[model samples]
Target: MRINADFTQRVAVHFDQTEWVASPAAGVERKMLDRIGDEVARATTIVRFAPGSAFAAHTHDGGEEYLVLDGVFQDETGDFPVGSYVRNPPTSSHTPSASQGATILVKLHQFAPNDRTTVRRSINGADYVPLFKDDHETVEMRSWPSGQVVPIDAHGGAEVFVIDGGFTEQGEEFARWDWLRLPPGTRTELRAGPDGARVWMKSGHLSGMV
Candidate 1:
């Protein structure tokens, strides 16, 4: 049940090269990025929901976090459109579905069991936004201008998901929907392509995760 489960090594996944695997739920599929267990596990994924599809109601014992990449995601809490970011803390319950369909980047069973904070929001028009920061992690949305070189300190580890345009790390290129993970103590720089790039990043959380 493990994908890129090694936290001590670097990993990169290009969206175009990955295949979608169906989940237990009908009409729902996922691209697993990393995993540490089966069924109920510590995992990161890209999920797509077909129109009129839904997942059964369930409680999150270890919390859940996600960002809507397209269409709309629905639940009793509300309907979230593209760019929506949400966190359902430990013990929260919901029945999620998509009316017309949707795609999201999700992380599951990755929070402190006692954590109860909840967050729901959307990405705005700003080029840079500090989404959230806590003792465990710092999440952000960043934009790079054409041909820019941006330095990043991955002292506590880091994960980045490309949302638009492209960038090169070391000598590897990352385009839209691509994902990259760097081990702790790594120092790196992203060199934006001709069209620049935009990304969602989470850092510090991987320090002691494995």
Candidate 2:
């Protein structure tokens, strides 16, 4: 089953408007943004766990990265509250559960072959840092101030997710939880709304794993 699986093109979706599809685990559901293959696939999703819900122990064969959007997500190692960003490298395993419930943005099977770093931290505590740097690829988080216009030049494609507040792009408004992906060589403009915004931005990584 493939959905927006093409890497050469662009894809965008507002998760707030997407339906929640149930996962194999009870009380857990997902809004898949892009996917390839079947049940075990390369995917990006917004996952929700109901109170007291838990997922069976599993290993990340390709890798897993996620950011908690709400409530608390827990595993054998520790509890991750909202705003927590975690990366479990290839071959890592864990039993994840939610005591009060949680919503998280997750990416699966998207790691580079030699990218084996394991990271876990709160977005609030970490300063903006470059995740990748190359002639065609770059990833970083930056501040978006209210009423400010920011230009974007997507040399090899780009993706953005609003982490707080809201913004407008090409006259379309995007609020918290909204995500956008643009094709290669596309030029775009972003204007922050009255509430301002904070965003996670990734450039390139659209045609190949970075």
Candidate 1 per-residue lDDT, tens place, 77-188, comes to: 9999988889899999999999899999999998877788899878868798777788988989899999999898998999999988999999999999999999888899
Clashing pairs in 2: none
Residue 133 lDDT, candidate 1, scale 0-100: 84
Error of 1 at 186 (Å): 0.9
Instruction: Give candidate 2's TM-score.
Output: 0.89
What local lDDT score does residue 149 receive in model 2, on the 0 to 100 scale? 92
lDDT of 1 at 185: 84
Clash count in backbone of candidate 2: 0
TM-score of 1: 0.97
lDDT against the true structure, per candidate, is 0.92, 0.82
lDDT of 2 by residue, 49-140 (tens): 99999999999888898888999999998999987888788888999999999999888887775666777767675547454455545656
After superposition, which runs of candidate 2 have C-alpha atoms over 4 Å from their true positions?
Answer: 125-139
Give the top-scoring candidate (TM-score): 1
lDDT (Cα, 0-100) at 1 in candidate 2: 86
Worst 10 residues of 2 by lDDT: 127-136
